[model samples]
Target: MNRGIPVRLPIGRGGGGISTIIIIAVLFIGARALGIDPMEILTGSPTTTTTSRTERTAANDEAMQFVSVVLAETEDVWNGVFQAAGVQYQEPRMVVFSGQVQSACGFASAASGPFYCPGDKQVYIDLDFFDELANRFGASGDFAQAYVIAHEVGHHVQNLTGVLPKFNQARQRMNQADANAMSVRVELQADCYAGVWANHTDQKGLLEAGDLDEALNAAFQIGDDTLQKRSQGYVVPESFNHGTSAQRKRWFLKGYQSGDEDSCDTFSGDI
Candidate 1:
């Protein structure tokens, strides 16, 4: 997710001749729609919330175990990839919170969605989001959840590879449109990395029939275009920090078919 403004503009696909103030206003509204404080996005001030851990019921326990197993699988895959490349992979910690959580990046609610914070080399997720993923987004299946975790882990890989740091620094100098375009590449690459993981998992005979469909559906459901259309009835391509549904699915399929990290590069000629 684009942590800067976290906006979902309702305007048309391109922001031609749109004023800065208008853009800011739309961003504020978008943040509000996501249950985030607009002021927090503007002022970079953290929200203070007394977050209690969700009581673990039988179902919650099962979900936790499932998440742990998926994470472990990612670790094994990335470790082997890094080892073969003569680099050490630093595993990231996962924090599964309830309503809210504090992280090195900043205070984030469940509304912020799952994110990998390069600041502290950690991934934060709210299990409730998985329910939302299934019921709200219509992307149901355990493999969809696994795809989410793997995508965040892919961000960790970007951090380790210096891709994220370079993007973060370079974005400071870019206009909103340019930055959003760049962010789409970043997010798509992460999706591709998740596909690479899926390929490895399949090789181990862990993926069942329909598993790839589950992941692809998840990617399509969460694409910027799809989400924008569902939420606001329109898509603002200029504000699409994540790729469109087609782009996301295509890149992921590319990675899965190739099963090579080199094929996951989205910084080249045309994404």
Candidate 2:
């Protein structure tokens, strides 16, 4: 991502999740061990303060700038796509945070990975996840990181098109397995949309050699099956919320090759 005008938003703090009872218990135990009053720890009210910006390392700062640029590019591409259909594109705000953040959907930790909260029409991310993507997932490179942002933005596209709510409603009436299947479709579609954005970027000569490979490797690395196998030592096909690595790679390539949104449809057909 070459330097582009960055969209800087206020970094919010004090998201509400993380087991309050467990946290208090730990604090109480620690206070007792230190000969301090547990009441002081328990009675201290949490103060609400804004974190306008988070401290960033040189690498993190560079990644943030790159993500900002990629986001701008996605906006340009999707805005054009929406305009072509005579529908207005509402650009989503990106909230960059460290550790944990509150979202309209709920509180989330960095381990939750990047996500789009349709409730607020915002994309939340922690740049440090890029390090995890590389070090743990073994998917590295600028385009790989850009794909993560684009995929979340893709969910925003789904929200604007009313796909997300419809799917959520369908999921509510479904069994766990069926709902997970629907979720896989939703996720794969986002992956496809990311590729659609990549198609546009490539047309503008923004892609370098190995960029597509990086994005594809990323899609493979994060596939539900791959993640599950590594964590659980077994694969449960019915529990997969995202497609398999092969499926992810195929769908992404389909979108990249066709460059047609219609071709990217994962519903009303066998996936």
Best by TM-score: 1
lDDT, model 2: 0.70
What's the distance in Å from true for residue 195, model 1? 0.5
Model 1: colliding residue pairs? 13-237
- Cα error of candidate 2 at position 156, Å: 0.4
Candidate 1 per-residue lDDT over residues 66-171, each given as its tens digit: 5555666677789889999999998776776788777777787877888778887777767788887777788877778778888888988998898888888899
> Which stretches of candidate 1 lie above 4 Å from their native place?
1-52
Off by over 4 Å in 2: 1-53
**Worst 10-residue stretch by lDDT in candidate 1?**
7-16
What TM-score, over all chains together, does every model reach?
0.81, 0.80
Highest lDDT against the true fold, candidate:
1
How far does residue 33 in candidate 1 sit from its true spot (Å)?
A: 45
Clashes per candidate (backbone, < 3 Å): 1, 0
lDDT assessment of candidate 1: 0.73
Residue by residue across 1-271, what tens digits does model 2's lDDT show? 1111111111111112212233334434543554444333222212011124456566555445455556666777898899899999997877777788877777777777777878777777777777777777777776787778888888888888988878766877899999889888888898899889989878876676777888888888888788888888889999988889888888888888877777778986888
